[model samples]
Target: MASGAIAAGLPAHELAYRELKQRILYGEFKPGRPVTLQGIADELGVGLTPIRESVRRLIAERALEFHGNRRISLPQMTHARLEEIYTVRSKLEPELACRAAAHITKADIDHLEAIDGELDRAIAFGDVGAYLKHNFRFHRALYAPANSQVLLPIVESLWLQFGPSLRVVCGRYGTSGLSDQHKEIIKALRAANIGAVREAILRDIAQGCTFITDELFANENQP
Candidate 1:
């Protein structure tokens, strides 16, 4: 939390790492589309050595994979992978939300409501990027009260893996009919109802995961 850690003071590789992760988490890169390390270094405005080190960290995190011919990209989706993601998400996310409900404040609820408003607008306007970004913001804010060190990172790792595929799904079928459970989560949080928080999160995960699963398998041969 030192001032030195801000912006330029951070190491080049660390800066590149954060930037690259955000790009992946927000679906700026498509799954299975490999790009060169030097290309990433140029885009990130950092040296090749630093970018390669950053990418090595991300690859260890499973956010990126080495494609053939010395390139990297977001991992492609598979049915088995989707099934594992859904199982892990369904278990962790609802628990995180419910734990959050136990300590969530009015300020937290207000923050979530604000995010949901933008999310709703994104859905209405078919703004895929905004939808992905805001939806992530809303969930992260909702769970911040929990102050979780363990479960939260696991959930985020799941999102990093899941976000690109959700992007593909949102693009194929526009933002219409995406999950509306944020409203339910907000309502429950405002009411201070822990049970309702759990329920809403479960439905939200199930609804989104189900859509992704159905869409991913609709091809029967999709990887």
Candidate 2:
């Protein structure tokens, strides 16, 4: 009974963490934006204790940084850090996708297809926020069947770092081509072709690399 109660409480804690993390990652709380424990508690309608705990976890993850006394903000992205993250993701995500392809069901494909539709709608309406939301969901859905809870959180942390910069890229280059990758991924999954799925996932990540690489060079050449 005690274990059951503890298990039940986990989701609420995770809920607090995820909500706070998403806001930080998605640029709802921009870099250098101040985050107060009480403000988050009030915004989330939770107690100060849970909000404090969530903030501490994020700080540990390097998603939130503290400076001087009592000031916290989202971590700023740098070119070297972005390169390192994409390198790690380039190695892991494709393998996870291939593993997931082996176990994917029709329902999983259906859900992914629906998410693709949402991406399309977000693109059509020029809603960057919605596009990012659906894009994250679509990628998560692709790897859901892998049951890799261990690596998934690591992947999410990478996303936390990558997500805001992705917003910058989308704002500059537009996101119309992103949805097209989903079609290829889904086709590979439907055929249960692990190699093809892996290649498609790698291709997707590589495209982001190309964009970020160009952005990095552009920033260097500025001024």
Name the candidate that leads on lDDT: 1
Q: Tens digit of lDDT per residue, candidate 2, span 167-187?
A: 776777676654447888988
Point out the worst 10-residue segment of candidate 2 by lDDT: 1-10
**Of the candidates shown, which would achieve the greatest TM-score relative to the real structure?**
1
lDDT (Cα, tens digit) per residue for candidate 1, span 19-104: 88888888999999999998987776677887889888888878899876669999999989988998999899989998889998
**How does model 1 score by TM-score?**
0.92
The per-prediction CA RMSD against the true structure, in angstroms, equals 2.9, 3.9
Clashes per prediction? 0, 0
